[model samples]
Target: MANVENRGNGSYRLTVILGYDEKGTPIRERKTVKAKNMKEAKKLLTLFEAEILTGEYFKAEDKMTLNNFFPQWLEKHAKDTLSPDTLQNYISILQKRILPKYGHFKLEDIKTIHVVNFINDLKKNGQRLDGKDGKLSASSVLNCYKAFNNVLSCAYRWKLIKENPAIGAKPPNGKAKKSEVYSKEELSQLMQLLDDKPLFWKTLILLAISTGAREGEIAGLEWKHVDFEKGTIRIEQAITEIKGKGVQIKGTKTGKERTVSVPEKLLEMLKKMELTSRQDKWKVRDLWEWPDHFFIFGNEFGKPIRPDSIGQWWRRFTKKNDFKHIRFHDLRHTSATLLINEGVHAKVISERLGHADISTTMNIYGHVLEEADKTAASHFELFFKKMN
Candidate 1:
């Protein structure tokens, strides 16, 4: 049985009595709630009593603040499940945004309104941590929302809360940025410029444009991965740098290995690069550090070139050559765009880019596909006119 007693203003005390304890004393549960009137108090009393009966009621002493629970969640769940980079990003979001605002709040006390307000605050006033004047980017806000939602979801799964407030909160709408790519004429001009550059830069840039591979993937390429006879390169690994950890070799971004075909001319360049590497190896025989590794893009001592160095070099090259500026990654977009313009099947393009699915390819290049469709219609119309 449950009872509610008005305690002045909008406050009411609710109490429920179970049978008897071992000493024949009444076992009681009590809670204080706020309501506008007797009717609301009685409704609250009913709900509280139901929660107790169903063993869903949380005791005050059992409540844990977000501050106290985050470390436990990180150790017990995040560490084992999330990748290092993803874990780091989540930690940054929690510490920078979520914890400062809500860490002191008990899991059960965090309401839907609180999460909604937080999201709104981020959209309206969240500033960049980099000391810039602008507000946080929409993508950054979305990351904060995702990380907070993930934390609350874990708390709900742990039975620390009756419901996840974040579940009801809407995130900011951040659209994916359009990719920049060189046109066919621009690509041809770039290739002509590469001919006079050092062999290393020429091969690397050409490989990037041909394979549509990531810079890290190109950095991680080994001599053994190239099959000259077949004119194919196996892309199974990438070199990545972690903050405070320096460089490391890791599986590809999607954790899937792919083989990409290359132009025969690029293979010949690779062979020349290989000969150069062997000659350099003979010169630095005792100084060579990674004799067993044999990376295609190794330095004078046979260590793979740092992945960031490739981008740094690209910035310098583009600046020195007075070329229209685009990111080294844009070269990959250039490759995919060129292929699409050449009427390559979307599935084949998807596979070449190591995308997880054809839908991903279609989504990223949908505009280009639409343009191609228009061109195809124009060609058909011209053919009919010519025949007539």
Candidate 2:
């Protein structure tokens, strides 16, 4: 079916999709005809369709709507090349933001003005589309814009577009939202609250707060990775949900692995937890075999529990207890913050957090680092006074 859309400037798009090429590739032979009204645009569309159907339309390689080319781009460019999460986000932005506005316009027809207007609209309409009443945060608007930019960048590289409209368009000016974390008092209360919770939940909270590992990294932990004598747990892989693929074990996001030391008491707790897991495994021997990797925190049948369930449970627990609700990820932030306040070195903190670079640690916890700096300055002042 053909689509006709107004492209502002006494012009309209007549999207006459030429049938697939011999290689099963769609040939979108779109045309922009000068028109003043819907009736004129419809007539132009009919004529373009006839010419396209009769094989009379001159085939220009670049004259195609982004909508027509997007499928090809995803298949040939993004499907295997992009990370599953990133590809999924691109798809989301297309459905929620990009496609409805610019799908009808040819790649060549998308100008700087179009890009500017799209960005402006995003800024103006920034609000959450969920059942909540708030608008989208600036950071969210920037993320959506980035997804939009990514598509146009690929189009430019492929020579489908003469210019990349997003190259010079104003970048999203949304302020970065501060990471939510638990205060020292709040952190203490949280641990106390979890003491009576299930072992699965309690251990998870402890590991996150103590190790500063990502939720997926913690979810991916295996029994074999813990060395009782060494008191260290190796983080080699992660179990994350890919868009099309269900929960799967994949390399870490940074593609690097590190080992974190466990406190002696916590190591003892882990040993006790292992005994409990073994007892559960005994009850379901047929479900799992020895030598098959065993997840540390698993469901009834010794299978990996849903990773999102950790966050969901955290939300529910806080709500039920009438506590200030921070996400499960916030536990990791709390760990870093507490470690920083305790005068831990940034390099050690970075290693514990599994960050590939120390700069990331410095950047995320800049405020904490700044406060640490102030304390150091105060100590220097006391030393100078004593010397005098």
Name the candidate that leads on TM-score.
1
Q: In angstroms, give how far residue 102 of model 1 lies from its true place.
A: 2.1
- TM-score for predicted model 1 compared with the true structure: 0.83
Worst 10 residues of 2 by lDDT: 122-131
Off by over 4 Å in 2: 1-59, 243-245, 289-292
Q: Which residue ranges in model 1 land beyond 4 Å of their true spot?
A: 1-56, 124-126, 278-292
Clash pairs for candidate 1? none
Q: Tell how far residue 141 is off in model 1, in angstroms.
A: 2.2
- List TM-scores for all candidates, in order: 0.83, 0.79
Could you tell me how far off, in angstroms, the CA of residue 277 lies in candidate 1 after the best superposition? 3.6
Candidate 2 structure quality by residue, lDDT tens digits, 60-169: 76478989988988998888777666788888888777888899988878887888887777666434667576667787778788887888898887767656998888
Q: What is candidate 1's lDDT per residue for 1-388, written digit by digit as tens?
A: 7899999989999999977899999888999999999999999999999998877888898899999999998999998877666778999989988899899999888988988888788776536788767777778888888888888999898888888998888777776577688998888889888889999999999999999999989999999999999999999999887778766788787888999999999999999999999898899998998767788999988988888999999999889989877999989999999998889988999999999889988988999988988988999999999998
